[model samples]
Target chain A: MNAHDLIKEAIAEKGKFDSVYWIACGGSMIDLIPAHELLQREATTFTSYIYTAREFDIMRPRRLGEKSLVIACSHSGNTPEVVEGCEIALAAGATVIAQTDNAGSKIDSGKWTTWVYPWGEGVPQAEVPAGISLSLAAELLDQQEGYVDLADMYAGIAEMDKILPPAREKVNAELGDRFAKLCQEHEFFYILGSGPNFSQTYGFAICSLMEMQWQHCSYIHSAEYFHGPFEATQDGVFYFLQMGSSECRAMDERALAFLKTHTDTLMVLDAKEYGMEAVPASVRAYLDPVLFYAMNCELRAARGKVFDHDPDFRRYMGVVEY
Target chain B: MNAHDLIKEAIAEKGKFDSVYWIACGGSMIDLIPAHELLQREATTFTSYIYTAREFDIMRPRRLGEKSLVIACSHSGNTPEVVEGCEIALAAGATVIAQTDNAGSKIDSGKWTTWVYPWGEGVPQAEVPAGISLSLAAELLDQQEGYVDLADMYAGIAEMDKILPPAREKVNAELGDRFAKLCQEHEFFYILGSGPNFSQTYGFAICSLMEMQWQHCSYIHSAEYFHGPFEATQDGVFYFLQMGSSECRAMDERALAFLKTHTDTLMVLDAKEYGMEAVPASVRAYLDPVLFYAMNCELRAARGKVFDHDPDFRRYMGVVEY
Candidate 1:
């Protein structure tokens, strides 16, 4: 079933929900952020939260009961913490919507509504985990409390499918080699982003740069830049700033202006410079993270080639037990 | 007025509130986190959130109306974004509780309820910004929805006043020189903490190390360490882990075990090892951040002496305009 239909069915079955929780780990947790942000921005009657799976299990929020709706994701569908969280939610009589790329895994158990989204080569933009989660969030918001921009958000998702592929290629052709060269030259980096696009900033810092490339990095919120992290800004430091087209864009603009004067090695990936203009202005900010995610993936792939290290290679994860 | 009396008066004036927002920037923002976490963990009817002041102003949550209580802080009481946030909250018909160390500053205007907390030498633990915020949160939760641990939390606060001074001095006497040496040897470090203690980890990395000492750093959530940042752990890397006596202690323990195996330079400050045994176990977890904060201040002061960089010194903060 499609994301919207699945969410509709869940709402219909549950009758009412006072809270929605997005639970996952690592990249999966990061992927659900835009959806959580959407609910935070749009939902009035209902509250939303994003939790690292294990912490959710340990904290066991008192509000996680019959009136709660949990949307959890695990790409492998067997992440122990996520599966446990699904079980915890189910035991609490909360409706659970589980999304995964791998089917028939532990998380695919028929106890909850299971969503299998496309992954790997040639996957449409709307079929990715983030897309499915976002669509579900928009639908839930529309059904629960009328979202005026619901139609625009749907159109934006469709526009992403058409524009993201070419945008990724264009970014690769224009800046891939330069980004790769910078990656080779610098061993550490500070990444900045705000609003929904912070998911991309965080994901790139942790998953791609630190985990995949074995580099050290810190991801700072653009809004918090002037507060403390900006003091670390100076020449000879590597910085990558992700500029989004959102209300929070002012925060990014301020950080960009400061970085321009302070740092010589600053790389900026602005969503507006890409093909995001085709997306509806009402929903453009929500889709900015999707554009940033695709661009980062392409750039990271280039860095992998330059450094002679496969992005998929890991020394500790999966190979060692904790 | 005392925090509890002020919160009670505000609740009486407002009649009812369904949500609480803690908004501030930099260390002030970090200080509010424990209170927000306390509400998240204990409050059943009221939802809680922490937001950077500018982001809160830009993304004005739809829920910020008559049914909302906003607790905002700015140390100097003249932070532009925080002052603006208080105005926005007041305009939205929300009860605004403004906390600051300074009097008669913009944030101290009589438009909203202003709270002046103690700062500088020999301030009582219960009168600090974080202590007041946490007390306000506890009082609100107790009066609104019956927090069973309210009395115990108060007891914990009083215990903190009796214990924190000596605890800070002991930590300094025991680990000061070594921590300073580590700071001088390593230019970049990873600080890890879980649950409420994550506030100290973040505040130390951004405020003390990066902002004041001009060192590079990343603050990783203990729960998220294994997810991605663990790959960056190696022999030469420096790591400081804060272990708390909370349900989320398991997360910190796991990270500690792995860090011990991978890194040669690791410093750990466990709340259990400190003099927190005197505090009631029921409220010990909530007060762990307080202990960590005090210990961090002492250690950072030692590092400041060694590096000849005053913790109060800033390169850009008040020196330049954004």
Candidate 2:
């Protein structure tokens, strides 16, 4: 059976996987957060725990055992912490699922899984990094939400595929120049979100700005605005709010109302405002992160051209004995 | 019973607490992290969760119920989020343990237990807000490690009290002037820590600087250094590393090694490096945050003088509407 079928079969099986442990770090951890949040909303019988890859390596959570299902990911297929986690989970007699950018890399020794995205015709289908997270979420949801929900999600994905081009074109043509112009003008940025969209808020702040553009940015939760982080807010401060139609939307609305009063440079990327016509209302909340990613790329695309630095190149990633 | 004995009795009662829910925010949340971490380390039967106070108010975890013990704190006893969290957790039938500087504060209502620090008797006996967290931790540990272990911690606390005078005197006499000289040198500062000390590291960064002193700072986890925040590290960048004992020490060591190699301005606050002779090995690991707080105050003492900012004054704390 294929990876999706295998995952569904595992979920369908009785008396298995009483607990789900997600072992991931950095980018992988960010991606898993949405699925983790969704699982909390949907799966009542499943006790879920998420640990940073190194913490998992060190703590070896007591509940992880024969009845546990460990889902770990590393796009590079050789992230040291993920590899160690997989090895330890396998040794503990827990079922292991590995997600990697390449199939034959170090992360492939466990239950094999891959996420393939369809490329244009005449070009081979591309296996994208971190795509497995989305597939993993959908497969798990297939058990609770039924195959029809999965079908609806796919239709939504296809619908997004159709409208994404024009959306990107419009975003680039209109907001791209504006983002590029305003990007450097702000010394620091704070990105805020709640619910599943929180992952994008964090990913954009850390990945797109900190790691990619070497800019100063911090991600704050919408539920935490009145806390200490808001002390830094001022009239001219820039903030990007990734608002979605999740259960925690009220939290974001409250935060946005406060930020709008405090700062003039507030940008709200509402998933509802975007064209999501084909997405069923029942499953729309789950797609917020996916839609947020599409919107986040616009800022990334604009900043990539404006800045001289390449996001891929790192000074100390694999250099000099780290 | 005394507070310590009462807590121990609560823990000993059969099936009274199946889980622990820590409801806190910002500085309060940071103070609670060490206790939360220690609880996770010691409590095997207990399922524990730490949430920002507002998040706890909005999301209210399904696990929080009659069988859960919710520990929530606010120094001033008037943080709106903590008040809401206390109300919600009490309404949900969870036992509430409230920590505050004042016993008569609003958080003491509705079947709530309180931890009140002595603020009188000339020069205040140094009402360290984080001290409440450590005491709370010791109370919980009283169940697992017994009263003898808690006694050892109290002895360590007394020992630190003896040396703390000299430490503070030296910090104020010698380092105070130097810090004042270099107060405005850096644009932004990063605070790093691991293990129990992580809480103090976060509290010092957010509470002492951002909220109180009106400065910019960010607290990054030591294990997360390589992920995104490390991209901003450079030759002249300053980072204060609150290295400590406990299980996660190795994680901080790795991050410190990298920071030392890259930056000449690395400040390492090692509890062992300082005069901690009176502190016993059995309880030394837990004193990391306590010791780190002492060292952090030196910086605060210095900065408060140089910047013409009182750490106690606020622009919009209880004085204004949210």
Give the top-scoring candidate (DockQ). Answer: 1
Question: lDDT per residue, candidate 2, A1-322, as tens digits?
Answer: 2447657666655344656778777777876776665555444444566777887787666666777778887767778888898888878877777766665778876453433232232221112223345456666656644444666655554455555566567667767777766677875677888766777887787667776676776677787656666766777778888877655678788888888887888877766666654567655655667667666767776877887666666777666577
For model 1, what is the alpha-carbon lDDT of residue B64?
87
Error of 2 at B109 (Å): 1.8
At residue A76, candidate 1 shows an lDDT of 91
Off by over 4 Å in 2: A1-14, A38-47, A110-174, A275-287, B1-4, B8-14, B119-183, B275-286
| lDDT (C-alpha) at residue A16 in model 2 | 46
Runs of candidate 1 exceeding 4 Å displacement = none
> Which clashing pairs does model 2 show?
none
> Clashes per prediction?
0, 0
CAPRI tier of model 1: medium
